[model samples]
Target chain A: MSATRDLVGVAWTGLMARKVRTLLILLGPIIGVASMVGAVGLTESAKGALQVQLATLGTNLIIAQAGGTFGSQNPTLPGDAVRRVDSVSSVTSAAATTNLSGVISVPVQGASTYYEAFPVPVRAADDSLPSVLQVRLIDGRWLDSADRVLHLRSVVLGSGIAKQYGYLPGETRTIRLNNTNFGVVGVLGKVPLDPTLDNAAFVTQWAAQHVFDTNGKPNELYIRTKDGTTAATATVLATAINLGGPDQVSTQVPSNVLAAQAQANKTLQKVALFAGLLVLTVGGLGIANVMSISVIQRSSEIGIRRAVGHSRSKIGAQFLLESLFVGVLGGVLGALIGIAVVYLVSSLEHWVVEIGYGQIPIWMGLALLVSVIAGLYPSIRAARLEPLETLRLG
Target chain B: MSTQDPADPGPSPDPGDPTVQLPTATGLAGPAVQPLLELEGVSRVYGEEVEIYALSDVSLQIMPGEFMSIVGPSGSGKSTMLGLLGVLDLPTSGTVRIAGQDVSALDDPKRSRLRGQSIGFVFQQFHLIPHLSALGNVETALLYRDIRPRERRQRAFEALDQLGLGARADHRPVQMSGGEQQRVALARAIVTEPLMILADEPTGALDSANAAHVLEIFAGLGTPERAVVMVTHDPTVADTALRKVSMRDGRIVADERRVA
Candidate 1:
């Protein structure tokens, strides 16, 4: 152990004797490692953010819309489409949704005016609307099958609509759509991702058909698959539904979109990884060049040491240790700088910092390995130096 | 006589002189004291197509307590002889024995160990490591030894003090005068207390006063258990030794013991 420590001390002294050259040699690896770490951190955080956004749109939900001419309004789905999709083996439940523009009146508490009229968007949906859209009810009750059978004029208000009209659960507010009035029975909590749902009122499909003449049709069908159903099953269902309506229906599975996005992100990660390795290879070359010069410059000292009884292997080990020290020092400095860069950029972009701490050891290990490989030739060259020849030159 | 084989082992030409005696196969004519260093018919050749003979048919011996000087002009193979004696290079065809061990048969690492344990060297340039302090430079001599760190430092300090550089122990080579640096190199050389000390122009870079001081130190180092071999071109420096060997064209022409 003492022998090893002595060799390490000698190596350290040799490096300290040439501080400027050492720092200059370290610069290349420092920049390379820093950029590599920073790129990995940035890519990971971006992927995390994308995953969060994808999660907001439930993975199991698939939206099927009527595919019509681009400029024209999308054609509505047949009235029985919801029941037909719900009956599919892979689909757990389905809901049909339609939207109409309407006017609503809310009673004023302290004014002489009897009511105030405001434009409100209205949606027609079934009892399974909350399950299909992943929505929660703040108060009151949703429209059930009995209401549709009885043709009761009942409505549910979104949080935004409720706030705007000062409507509460059990409130007898009438909303007029195409000169027909419906009673509000429930208020929904905010649906952040679906802004249209947050600012609209909802009623049963039967009431919507009777009141607004939708002809028993809906703008879109929302299907929730069984727990184990894959995205391919959703496509199969959409194909079955559009069997007689060619070029008139479109299918969208959020999980499939997310999978495609993840695949592209993987390719991008691989490219970035290749770039980082290329930079590191360049840095390794720089290390090799500097180490070669160091060996040449210190040939006389090596000869002297050999004459003083140090073996050639000891001399080789000393140079190898010096280069290893540079590698470790550069790795440590680069990791800190990379982390700092990652944090700064992430904060600026309001992204969650997602650096993998586990990767740090692996990266440092790789840097050290590269440095050792780079130093091998120089160390061997130093060891092979004939003391007689070197001292003669000196 | 010129065409006769050099390895005939017969009396050399001009054998009438009694002061110079060629070494025989039975080794030096003394049985009581073993020679500290011995080279028998040593020859060193270098290069391929156009071979160069650095040292040819050189045979010599030095017993303990001998202060000998090898004096020669340029290209007389003084450096090559020193390298062979120092175990830094093996002779092309001959035997080198140090303290009765055949060193020419040892491998590189074994030879290094033998050099570390049995020999010390002082170069003409005072080859002290420039970055290390005088004490640190001396300590390097014991680095390959099994000495503890504290003992190594203490011995190095004592060595420096003996060289009259106790106060300059902390000074680096660049901060010291040439003479002081040479003394530091001398201290490094003697720190190991080896069987022999080899000085290659030890005082070549010193002034007359510093040179005298270094020669006094060298003269004082030759105890009954140790020997010293110095190579020099300065006749005045060579005259300080108890015995002198003169070389011409890679062969020793004369070996004379002076009345001290």
Candidate 2:
């Protein structure tokens, strides 16, 4: 028999002789591998993009809101809930907010009697609320502990309310709430995670209890934990906020949603990979059909080769080598097409591009294995042909 | 015909006869000068229910340094005889030997190896692979052998040059004329330098000029170390060989040697 290199050359020449037929046969494997590669790359790129967004959105943030159940018509956290939560081991920061009982109206300009046209709710926030929520102020400084100690009656207007009143930091405008005049301290920007806060006005909890007759009980507690500790912090946060009755509060860690989304993405990847493999099997069948037809068409060539000196196994090897060439070429082309698709889709969607370049060899190996299996029958049939009969027939 | 028919031509001494076992070309010169191929009482049969003997009790000896032809009309078993002589088929009832080894005793791979190393075939239709160039077609004979690519290419070029086809080595079969294609097939046959060349109607598809040229090349190919056997139906083509064996009804009717 000839050396494998020579056989490869012969096989290559045979394939090149029928360029159109070979390319048509290659189409199946190319599309199959392309779908598989594209699916993996796009999912990975999407996961990378999600991770970036989650990192910026703060994975360690936990929110505990008082919820009413069957036993209680109204549920409220303990008055010292933020203090208790701040004492937890992993808690980096804690804040609380509670709305006042009655609606507060901003007086219309040049009107003696208040029309109550814009009844923006006034929320009482702790001194650390701005830091825990990680909100940036468009103008002026955040409310501090000294504002509560001195009862300065300072108010920070949310972005939506500030825009409505044309309020800016250090402006001479005084907002009157419940017949008490409060100086504007800051104007908050948009809060993407919590849009409800974008329409409310904030004041210190101490000032709310003293001037606005609030019950001094927090309705919601926002806690920031150490990095990678959100899940652990959430487990103990409800009990920490309502020790007497932990069921009165519900804890939510937004990072868990990201984890669930990752799990869903993993499932989608498996399903897509299975679909790609199904198409690959069909492609392999296509190769088998082409190879079989090639064997039939080249029977005379087989006869000549046999008469010349080729053993049956050598003839089989030559045919298999041709099939392997198809597989490897298709794999390379498919991988390139898949990478291009991933980059195109990722760029259009503004996602991070992540390709598994390391898996390319494995994909090629898979194609080789598939083609070898597909070509087995045809090669063996070519080998089993009777030299005399084929020669006479040809 | 009976096995002991008196019509057997005995003018040339049989190499297997005891009297010729001395220091001569047909003697024990370390087995090199023995008959290149010998078939003793070889018979091929077909059909299970109704037996059909393609060849029955056919005994023949083909010596080295011989240029001979087997000529017969269709259905006279000449093709079957060629198959047995080329080691492409085994007999049903008797032994066929090539270079002192029994043909039927070898396995498929061994038989194929022996055929490849000892016998070369030229077909009637000039069955050159159309995709390969003339040189490439010649190299195919040596592909299954142990020769490296450089030497193989060199040898193929030499064979094509010997066929007066040196300038057309790069032409594919489809691009060449019928005569050139036949010459390329001849190059492929002789490239391996086998012990025997078996040509089946070598010039059947060629014009008179190409046929004469091919016959001339065949004449020069027979040497003391090799044998050339041609199977043809044309009496004119058979006349060119030094020895001619004529067959009819599955039996050798005449074995004649031309006066040199």
TM-score winner: 2
**Reference-based lDDT, each prediction:** 0.78, 0.81
DockQ (Cα-based) per candidate?
A: 0.31, 0.36
lDDT of candidate model 1 versus the reference: 0.78
Writing each residue's lDDT as its tens digit, candidate 2 over B128-171 gives 88788999999988875555578679889999998899999999
Clash pairs detected, candidate 2: none
**What lDDT tens digits, residue by residue, belong to model 2 across residues A1-394?**
3477678778899899899999988886688788888989999888777677666768788889888677874466888888899889999998888977574746334432542554687888887777787878888877887898887888888898888787755687787776777888888877655667888988888888898877888788888999988888898887777776655788887566775564327777888878878877888999999899989888889989888878898899888888888889888888899899999999999988888899866776787778888989999999998777777711
> What are the iRMS values of all candidates?
2.2, 2.3
Local lDDT at A387 for model 1? 83
- In candidate 1, what are the lDDT values of residues B1-260, reduced to their tens digit? 12234576344463321211223212433667778899999999999888899889999998888899999998899999988888888999999998778987777777777787677889888888887889999998888555557867988999999989999999999999988998998898888777789999988888989899899999998877678989999889999999999998899999989888
User: First chain TM-score in every candidate?
Assistant: 0.68, 0.78
Name the fnat for model 2. 0.49
- Worst window of 10 by summed lDDT in candidate 2 chain A: A107-116
After superposition, candidate 1 runs with Cα above 4 Å error: A53-58, A64-95, A99-211, A223-252, A259-264, A357-362, B1-31, B146-148
Once model 2 is optimally superposed onto the true structure by TM-score, how far is the C-alpha of residue B9 displaced, in angstroms? 49
Candidate 1 CAPRI level: acceptable
